[model samples]
Target: MAKNSGRSRTGRGASTEPARKPLWRRIVRGVLVWGAALSLLGAIFLGTAVFFTMRELPDYTTLMKSQTGQMIVVRDRDGRELVSLGPSYGKWLSYADIPPIMAKALVSVEDRRFYDHPGIDALGLARAVYVSLTTDRRARATSTITQQLARNIFLNNSRSWTRKAREAVLALALERKFGKDQILELYLNKVYFGGGAYGVDAASRKFFGHPGTELSTAEAAIIAGLVKAPSNYSPTADVEAAIGRGRVVLGLMVRENVISQSEADEIDFSKVTVAKEKGQDSVRYFTDWALPQLDMLLPENKEPIEVWTTLDRRMQDAATKAIDGNAPKGTQGALVSLDRDGAVLAMVGGTDYVNSNYNRATSALRQPGSAWKLFVYLAALEAGYKPDDRVVDEPVTIDGWSPKNDGRNFAGEIDVRTAFAYSKNTIAAQLGNEVGFGTVAAMARRFGITTQINTKPAMVLGTSEVRLVDMTRAFAAVSAGGTSVEPYGILKVTTTSGELLYEHKSAQGQVLVPRYVAAGITDLLQTAVATGTGRAAQIGRPVAGKTGTTSSNKDGWFLGFSSGITTGVWMGRDDARPVGGLSGGHAPARAFAQYMRVAVARRPVEPFDTELKLPDWQLEPDDEQLQGEPGEYSYYDENGNLVHPDGVPGQDELPRYEDGSVGPGPGPGGVPPGVPIAPDYGPPGAAPPAANRELLDRATGRSVDDPGLRPGQGAVIPVPRVTPIPRATLRPPAGQQP
Candidate 1:
């Protein structure tokens, strides 16, 4: 009974011990089961991620063909590079050629374990997550250098989950495809380093004034630090901030054993010198002018292209020098030169394109003043008038408006050629009226004056405004024997692969003006240049042009042309105020002369074609007519005596034609007005017989050689005489004359 009680107590005591096992063993068993299950879940998640990432990955072939940016190279007509516009990326450096310091600085500051990682750093990521959890801070980026390169080369920078996943996938694929050196080389080249510089080489040159391979430790660190915040830490833009960031890089390099602490301490950020921004390139004006035309020229092209232009570098330099040397202070100027085919050889829009981009050469409508007289005289030539036709330069009023000459004085009975040479405003106005204002306007349009013109009589004095290019084109038409030409700059366009995109060809069209008329006008303009207002524009060669000064001297213009080139120059203040009395015959003409001397130095002097025929009336009036009254009605005999209706010497003559007269009557030779005078019809020194003259007049219904007639008998009508008449009396019945 005792033994049984002891056994029962022992069993109870053992059972009461609560099955005690080692505490560590129990905990180990539970941890093992849970850990295994979690590991399985992790494995599945990683496998699935790899699957999706690989599926979204771009083919390596596509990646190889992709470009980070497009490049546009503009070359001059001679195939010389004028300017390069785009994200400037210097020559690509191979991995081996990259400076060791550059790579060291990049790796130390960006990713210390760049070589050891696949695409993501496991230890770094864990630390980032742990800091976020414990310190209540958001997780920091743990992207490896490879990841950054992948994103920069192929992906958009977005913070969305999808973009991040794609970036990670692309990064892993990049790492798998490229070795560590290849990845680093691409990162160094593909990264943006601010200031329109892309890649290490360009950044080094831009910020340090040196090439990438020659960068020192400090320079390398300075550039490397910019990758984090390029604009905020640009060495040229924010030196202090950039130095601060660079110090951080130096300290990191020290920590990574890339440099000794002493070496970093001895570095002086203050002594670092960055390259100065270069002066604005002169070609920027041309590029700015050409940019808007790109869309129309290459609407379907999304890739970059090269444009070959017709800009003659030598001529451009000459024009620029001319403008700079001649433009008065506080005033702006523009110059445009075109070849005979109307290709823009040189175009200078302003004295300084950096200060202003307003391309006055192609834009900026200013009144052309007397330079516009070319069209007026051209209209006159088309209106059966000859260059030698006599015109009264006396002040004349039309519809209550009187236009005066530039000198405010008139020379009586000047020939058309002499009047034009002097830029006679009164004669131009008179001719404008005689030919009709509408006819003058139409003639100007035919000459390629695309601007709106006023029909008022003052338009003969260039009251209307026109662009320099359009005006230059007009003059070029005259230079080209009246053929119309559209000015062009771009000669051709080609892709980087040498594919032809566009080529400029001259447009075909009928001549805008008759060759004879152009030749006649050219002759008159040449006379002007030779002895008149444009005398300052003589270039030791045969050149023709017109000088124009607007009212009050607000705008000055000298538009001239050589046998092979036509150039137009304008000077004025932007505010439209007077240029302190700078006339077109002064600075504008001087600049034109200066440019033309250089432009035509190699070309031969070519005189204008002047073999055109002239009408009998336009021939030099008989020596006696030179002494006639300035009035339009006066006629003179061969002996310088005023002639009368009876062909007798007298001071006053009867009206040449009467009111409502249809034909002229016998006076001198008795030839009708419309009848063509035979080349040798009359004796040189003797008057025709009266009986023969009377017979000729009866046969032709009028006298062709008649200089005067009764009030109602001739084709030439006098100004109607205003005789005072009594007021009309009202009559009580119709048909009653009061």
Candidate 2:
């Protein structure tokens, strides 16, 4: 019993020594604790920096809203929408609302395996890394869909390694904060499509005129491929590339088992279904019309809004095609068709919407040339100049500013019909002076030519610059028979949910002129095609038009209309340089005629709503038919009155003497004395005198005086003497010479 107690005390004594740990374990524990604490602090710093950055960002909503302004939706008379103008963006829909096929196609084409990745695909990152290490190229971006969305909404199309890094970080954050579906939805809604489309939905409707859900398999594939590069796959811009991209999308679908391989392989690449884009800027023009209404609806920084218009796609297409075919080569053109009530039917800004977005028809202010004279003549008619009133076409000058006729010749006494038919500048100038430049300027403004008129006599000749919209609108007033209609681009603006925002109304007012007076002017203009300078504008239907050619051949314009449409065409270089020797009648009219031929092919024939009455004037005898009066009887002396047979008093009497002076006054062909004699210094009266002394001497090869002679002969020139100088003396007899 004593030994057992001793052993127990010994075991207790052995436990008194502490247990030893390995040096490596102690080092690991200390390192892990310190590393964890530092990581936490670094994360806190990063979070704080991110928070401050977010706080300093500009308000996106406010920034976008301040830009909403006057929007116009252009449409045809049939209420078919052509273009949307202003800050118009299409409706936004959630990714859940998007078709499954659309989503699959997009994912397959843009980023396959999107669902399997966390913001970024590890495989894609690895591939990018491998490429960067082995290849001589810059590193490829390894961004996810969320990253693209963030960049599109808040950044530029910058291509930098730093930007790529930011995108990756933002993408991870975005994915963690928002659901995958929400991220995709924002991405689809925030991209830009060609032709001013803002989102996939808007793009679908714009290219195909159908909703996103209604897209065909091929159409959907084409659109989905565009998200990667819109211009590269734009059907209008790069058709071949778009087809190639469409094929690539189809192949991806087959590869992903989204569609049967057989079906994908059997797909016809040759037959791509591209819906015809109606007018050039239909949606943009409509947006242009609707922005003002949107401003009034929610004037503050407005969210991207939707607007519906009454532009007809077919009419818009026709108008666009017509303008493209008619506008001069290398020259931009614009067309705006409107109803009598000032509602725009179709509008085309330029031939290629992708190349130029300047909207020349509404925005470019060019001189209207003779197109403005319609108003001047209208004013004259209102001032009581009848169609048959006599107006002299003699050369005239007004206030030191002379206006020449289109051609150099002047027609003696023409009636107003012929005068207006010829676009006689002298007659128009006289009318402007008679009716006052202020009156003509006021009349032009009333008819919608609202640009500044010089109020000089030249303004009557259309020297003032005006926009195509204004010039056509002024002619439209004549087309509508005097009730001026303001040219407008918008019909109505609305929200995505069909809430009415605003509507457009024509500008109201009248510059007093009776309907009959305006009709009379229209009648005169019709004759412009029938027989005048605008004859080339004659269409199959009864047409009325005016040809306008600016000085120096700088601008050529044709503004005309059938019973249905009034269109204006201006052909000139953008730099305002002169064109290749063209007149308004030849190039501009031919282009206008060619376009109208195609545009009006399907349109029904309609006549102007005015009575056709022939005036009591007959065609005057042509120059060839009018015999010139005998030259002897026609000319007069300096007084300008007709000369009598008794002749010009002692100045120009024939050498026949009534009392028979010196052999019948030297006969019929005689040269008499005091006939304003030319000097002859060849020995006084030598050989009936060589009047042109130097010329005769030169012709005969006779010895002539040479200045090089020894101080004896005058200077000898090879050519005839122009004028003789008085002989100089070294010492002048001053007073006597003076």
Candidate 3:
């Protein structure tokens, strides 16, 4: 019994020992799994680093050779570049090619340990990390100059973790592939210096009007400051801020031992001379207008080429000064100056492009108002109406609608010149009807009114929308002796390397009006400027123009042409609401006068084309011959069909003459007994017509110019109120004519 008890105790102990074994084995397995996971993670990290390091950087040669870039170069008429555009695809240069002070300033501002590190410094990384975590910004990460260059050249400027990783990898790769000098050269050459200038060479030339190697310490420091934000630090872009930034750069140069402390301190950054040509050509107006022309120049590839335009730099500067200095408060203005051939010389779309890019000179379309009257008078002249012809300005109504003059009253009698000089709406409306509204509209289109023109009779009163550029171009046609030419800004385009790829010569189309007629029109417009609405536009030279003001005076425009240039100025609120009391002859005219004063200062005073001298009669249309009842042309009604109401016979019939003796007018049934009476042709309900059957027969084929026919001759045509045919009247109440 003792032996059996001992054996059972041993088996129990053995079974209990298995629990300890299981605990130890589980611990060992857990440790092994953890170790394997750690090894795999380490491999992944190493593999990632290796992959990035092995990736090749983008080649600089290829970047320059690629055809998907733009380099906009703006030049003056004298072929001096006002500015150059260099956003991408720019060349690379060496640090030595840049001013030494600039090199030191960049190192001082960006990477203080640039020369010490291969690509990135560990200390910088740590500091950057701490700053990033605290400041909540990605730029807190410190990238050496080499690393920054690598990122700029090979990686995008995205502030992301993936991009960061790639940037580090590329930086390391760049250090490994290139020598320190080569890396510095690439960075200097590839860095952007803002204001559309790229690379050390281009930037140096842009900012200093000289080579990079020759920049002074102050200028070099300013250029260095541009590395962070070129637009923000450009002296021309932000003078005070750029100067302040330059001081910071100079301070860094002192700390970096680039220059003596005294030299850095003595640097007179207070008056850091801003490079005149550093900023763009102030060609905001031309830039907008020349875009479409550029598209044609480079139709195949979208690569932007440098354009050399006919812009006069001095003139552009004068224009900017004039517009900014004299523009009235609370009012916006636009000025466009194009040469006689339609080459834009200077254009200021607004007083300032930085305030708003909404180009008022080219984009805004306001009512031409009286400026459109030029076409009105031009059409009248074309239709055999003389400038000296007499037209009564009494109250006139066309189909129950009466148009008022500017002040709602008419002058009794005035020649066409006087009527036009005073802008008599009644007389102009009369002339429009005589010439036909469609004829005036067609003439307007020919003279460059691209928008829809109202063919309604009110169109004679200048109620149509037209863009400033189109208006300028149309007026330019007048200045160019009636030969219409497309307005152009770019005269030539060349590659940055001096390849003449495109050139624009003068493009002329058909003669819109006869040369003598053009001369006559010019003379009349000159008269307008000298003594009438455009008197304010009178410079020392002969000028021709018209002023336009919409109803309630919301928008005002003055468009004029000198012997050498044509300019258009418009002033208005953006909302198109009524300004209520302004006249086109006032503000817009003053602006024109201001701009022209500056323009004529440099130009030689020249008279208009005197070769086409006019005999007194040549300027006026002939009045001896009748202009053929002013032919009532067919026009579509709302339904788009032709109808002549006066020609169509209604159901009402005439009374039978009864052996050619007069009798009471017939009724609707056409009998002499119980003749139906017609209403009188006076005030709403005064007429008691005896169904005047004789009136209808007498009105048949009556010429509008028939002298014997008095007012209210033709029967009122019952068609829509499109034409101004007079209402029918009874035969002077029975015996006045006999």
Model number with the top TM-score: 1
The lDDT, on a scale of 0 to 1, for candidate 3 is: 0.68
lDDT by residue (tens digit), candidate 3, 6-29:
655445454544334687788999
Candidate 2 stretches with Cα past 4 Å from truth are 1-20, 32-97, 101-302, 306-337, 346-360, 363-369, 395-397, 400-404, 506-511, 575-581, 595-738
- The digit string of per-residue lDDT tens for model 2 on 209-325 reads 777767667777888878777777888677788878888899899888889888887777566556676554534543454345545645463444344454556766667666666
Task: Work out the TM-score per prediction.
Answer: 0.70, 0.60, 0.67
Winner on TM-score (2 vs 3):
3
Clashes of 2: 38
lDDT winner between 1 and 2, please give it: 1
Candidate 2, residue 412: lDDT: 75
User: Evaluated with lDDT, which candidate comes out highest?
Assistant: 1
| Candidate 3 colliding pairs | 93-189, 386-621, 554-579, 678-689, 679-687, 680-687, 680-688
lDDT at position 210, candidate 1: 77
Distance from true location, Cα of 113 in model 3, Å: 6.9
* Per-residue lDDT over 1-738 for candidate 1, one digit per residue giving the tens place of the 0 to 100 score: 435555654455545456778999989998999999999997788667766766765664454335556656677999875765676666567788899999999999999998887888888989998998899799996688987887887678888998787777777767776678877887887788988777798798778877798888888999999998899999888888988999999999999999999999999877788887655645677667765676777757644467899898888889999999999999998998999887888888888988888888888999999998888888778655677666677777765679878878978767788998999998888777665555566667877877776666677898888999899988988888878877888888887556888888777645876677888888898989999999999988888899999988999999989867999999999889987879998999999999989888878888887556544333223422653422222334333334432343332332243354333334587755632222222334322221233353332223222222112222132212222111131111335332
TM-score of 1: 0.70
Clashing pairs in 1: 658-711, 658-712, 670-703, 671-703, 671-704, 671-705, 672-703, 672-704
